[model samples]
Target: MSSISIAWIALPFFVGFVIYLLPKLDRYLALSTAFASVAFALWLFVVQSPINLQLIDHFGVTLILDPLAGYFILTNALVTAAVIIYCWHSGRTSFFYAQTIILHGSVNAAFSCSDFVSLYVALEVISIASFLLIAYPRTDRSIWVGLRYLFTSNIAMLFYLVGAVLVYQAHHSFSYVGLRGAPPEAIALIFLGLLVKGGIFVSGLWLPMTHSESEAPVSALLSGFVVKAGVFPLVRFALLLEEIDPIVRIFGVGTALLGVSYAVFEKDTKRLLAYSTVAQLGFIIGAPTVAGFYALTHGLVKAALFLTAGILPSRSFKELREKAIATPVWIALVVASLSISGFPLLAGFGAKVSTLENLMPWQVIPMNVAALGTAITYAKFVFLPRGGEAKVGTGFWAAIALLIGGLFIANIAYPEAYTIANIVKLLLTIALGWIAHLLIFQQAFVKLPRLLEGFEHLIGVMSLTLVVLFWMMMA
Candidate 1:
């Protein structure tokens, strides 16, 4: 691929600034930018890349668009398009569009990075852009949660920067390849930062609230694309550190279970999706190739779920039965929910089956349990409120249609996904999930959708996570 093609990374950034200058044309510009992005990502993926050729190279800075980065860019682009459409349809302004579009560029920048310094700067930009989007509602709660997210993200990135410095001091290079030569403490610190930033395990305690509190389109971007900034690089880094794989899987399994436990009891629909994002990320990180595809599956499906939530008049489980929803919204809700639950013929089934295949036989059982919990958690989506407006916004259908199309991605190539055994397993899981929900999960106890309610607690969790990560690496 030509180096000029790499300018695609900066497209959204420039368009986003133009969006700021021409607030009235935000919708048109943003839509063009989002689609053009998806096209470029696909174009890059289709073309052969020279592995040794840097997409961008300069004084102590470098970037590349290898297959791995291409995959992540595609995932981010697909979701950002959906989110951009949903935001415009939902009547968000140019200012909101500016932050989200800029955030999209930041994500692309992050995934393109080949050096720790570049990655750190990209992530910091991501934090600033996401913080703006998170606080868009300007409510006391939105502001507070946004600040919490910003505070945690900044601290995490700061730690990462220090680790990067140490890596350079020891290895005299900032490239990921140099990680193998760096001090163990440096790598541990970097991993800890990524885990927190990516919303994994104890370090990710801020995720549920931060994601749940943001507006739906904003939440979609956060869940679908932003968190990958932390984990996507880790997948590449694992190639350099063989020991990191087992460590990542242990945390992945824990995150999967713990995240679903919170989701099953969540009172708010948005909060449930937030926890599910955490759970799904936990699910996605188990195997490298599977992680990539599963992350793509999740990016599309979760964005649809959040956008579906946005369209519903109801905000909680109980409200679903009582409220009226547009027919399209109702349909989108079921599809997105079922997709996340790994229903047959959907995106989740293929990626998740691949994940299960790659897991240790013993590990498969808990992930299956996590899958079952996912079905149970999403079953509440079925209440299918009382009424419908035939005239939902064009943007809603446009966005939902695009996402639904993305759902079948690469599933056609997976023959195993269509096997009778998997089909039967899915049916039984959903059936059992319904029974469990009817018998017990009835918001049996209010969870505040609660946990990690304070910023101090967030700091505490980060510190504890850092300590454990350090101890593990040192040992």
Candidate 2:
């Protein structure tokens, strides 16, 4: 079983290299490999129990296939498969396909790895591949965005490495399970580093620019899948350090509010979605199982929204209203919007309800506020007037169909999320959001201050956050 798990990690890189050499078959090969990867992950979920594999004795290189890890693996695989199909349909280059496959492999490895060493290696793999993919289009804006992402990622990983070293020195092992009683300093450093990856408010200031500037499909992948790599580990740490749960929850609430506040005022479609990703992640970090479900729904719906943005003639809400979009494209956008807004019977509603069920009464109010804010932000899309006729291809429709199907499947699978009270809450939230949009956003021209727009400013903020966290942990 361990060998099989290792093979799953290796399969994409091996297949990618081969496909890169055979450029003529790149599209077919990439798609086939993606589907096969998803199939293998699902099979493992059904047949396998939790297992830890010690690949190296002295180095403590280990892999874990627990139920929690399995859920992430499956989600990553599904999103990767959809993105590959989008890449093929959009006529991306062979290099793009190769990088995508490599990213898929790295993400799966990150989710399954049992030790800090293996996880760190996987993180590096993902970072390098993502940088290349974000810069793949070679536009001036994209290259600059990619570089910003690379620098921030390297700095965060350095923090993680230092924390991992501290843990190894204290415990003589780098395995997550072995670091049970590690010092607060070590845990704080590790948490701060992962927070940068998770797209949390202060540390993840690099997210909006990077996600909004990348190519549409790449934006989808970054927002929907890549950001979660940082988040999953953070959730694990929170579970391990129960003493820190209160602080994590406070950060989560603040992050959620900050994300939605910025998203509401942002006019750029992709940037709005990017901020929403940050906000949803903030909510998810408070509860792991609910986070898993939320991640799945968010990945699918967010990808679909990004892909839909790509096909639109213009990204400006006012311009989009003036131009005609394809019927299928409009339909896709509507489904994605409702899902993100937590409309009853949709994926977002189910996940939000499940998450709220696990929270304290006060925590529930903020989450509900965030959900309402999300709906209000998305209302612009719903009311945008449609004008010029555009034709969408089979690939676009296929991606949309797959995402919507996933949403329905999520709702069906999580029936516990559909109680009468939750259903009423969902309706009220949407109603409030709609009213807010009309009474506030539509009636006034508003713009929030872009305080974190500069990279240097973001670095300062991240530094300040680390200092504060350290002080808290020490005190």
Candidate 3:
């Protein structure tokens, strides 16, 4: 990589200095810092090269430049930018902006890392930063949530550490290239570790509590990029384990379906979004078991949508479902809802179609359920009562741009597309989602179905147990 690559490394440092010196310039500081980081990452797309560093003579780390990493970096940059814009007017503490800069920089580092050691260190850096960001406002609920995240995250990292030790003992290297034919036990253990951080079922217990409570911008970053830090690594590990055990495929599907089921009824808008993350991840995690492209699209679109969803004001959720939002927030929520529900011609649709195309019809039950579940949750937003104040801004447009960009990518990759069957299936999903909402979730229903409200989270806990059981059996 050129010197520009270092810009990614330097982002957090630069933001740190600004925060330290001109604390009062908080607004401009966040805007400029977010833009700078995205700009640097965008520049990386043009000046791509491999940057290898000697952490040790025997164990150096390499940063690889490829489409996969670029896609993620780009998504992270766009979402962060949108989030910063969304938060620009919100009365947040300067500390939040400063921490976001730090988190973004660490995420850049993590995405660029090519070795296990670098990846692990980078992951840890983001984890600590994320926990603090959650607790920064220092409310009792936030503090308790952050502590829960801290404890669970440390335990997950410990699992990663143990897995790392075993891998190093067996392969004698921390580089991803070092683990080519490792034992099944090591791969399974490492995945078990990573699943926790990836927000996969079971070990992802802390996600809802913390994610739903954090400040909107922070929540966007956490769901959008932070949690995904574990995904590519999981995909890599899954590839490594393909030969050892095919059953991991089963785990992925089960987890994905379960996540959608619980996400169906999650009450808090942010938490509902958080549960969808698990379901979205579940869809992609099952990708390695089928098609590489499925996983690829899922990661890109999921990250973008998650971040965009988080940046909008809390009113976006409540007003849409409980009462009409201000015109601007309502429009933004509409776009977000469409993007997440995978509406025909949207980014989510492409990801869902691609993943489903990679699976058998019988295997698509969960995929259908997940799509329906997501659609239903978002539809609830559509029902928000008549009116509120309106103010649309750059953040809202940024989300629309991302949704369009994702659609463009999908179209380019799969032209002469949109099978009639696919169209019918999508329409059916939307109809079912709407009908389900009317029957069970409508305000007139006088009571929200707790099962639908908390479905994704319930599935998350269940998936976690299933993973542990699978691990035990394999062990």
- Clashes within 3 Å, all models in order: 1, 4, 15
Residue by residue across 154-181, what tens digits does model 3's lDDT show? 7667766776777788778877766566
Decide which is better by lDDT, 1 or 3: 1
lDDT (10s digit) by residue, model 2, range 58-153: 466887677666656767777777777776667677898889888888888788776788888888888999999999978888888888888888
Q: Which stretches of candidate 3 lie over 4 Å from their true place?
A: 22-33, 36-58, 244-248, 289-322, 360-362, 390-416, 440-475
What is the RMSD of candidate 3? 4.7
Taking the tens digit of each residue's C-alpha lDDT, what string does model 1 give over 1-475? 4455556777888999999899999978877877777787677667747344343343266776766676678789888887777666566778988887899888988887778888888999999999999888899989988998999889888888888889888877788877886787898889878898899986787898888878888888999989998888787776457877777888889889888988898878898898898898888776665677788888988888888887677687777667677766777888888888888888878877788778866678898899889988988786556456745677778888988888876567466677888788887888898788878886478554344657888788877788888887776
Q: What is the lDDT of residue 394 in candidate 3?
A: 66
Best by lDDT: 1
Off by over 4 Å in 2: none
lDDT of each: 0.81, 0.80, 0.64
Residue 336 of candidate 3: its Cα lDDT?
53
Q: Where is model 3 poorest over a 10-residue stretch in terms of lDDT? A: 444-453
> Positional deviation of 94 in candidate 1, in angstroms?
2.2
Clashing pairs in 2: 323-387, 323-388, 324-387, 324-388
Query: When superposed on Cα atoms, how far off is each prediction in RMSD?
Result: 2.3, 1.7, 4.7
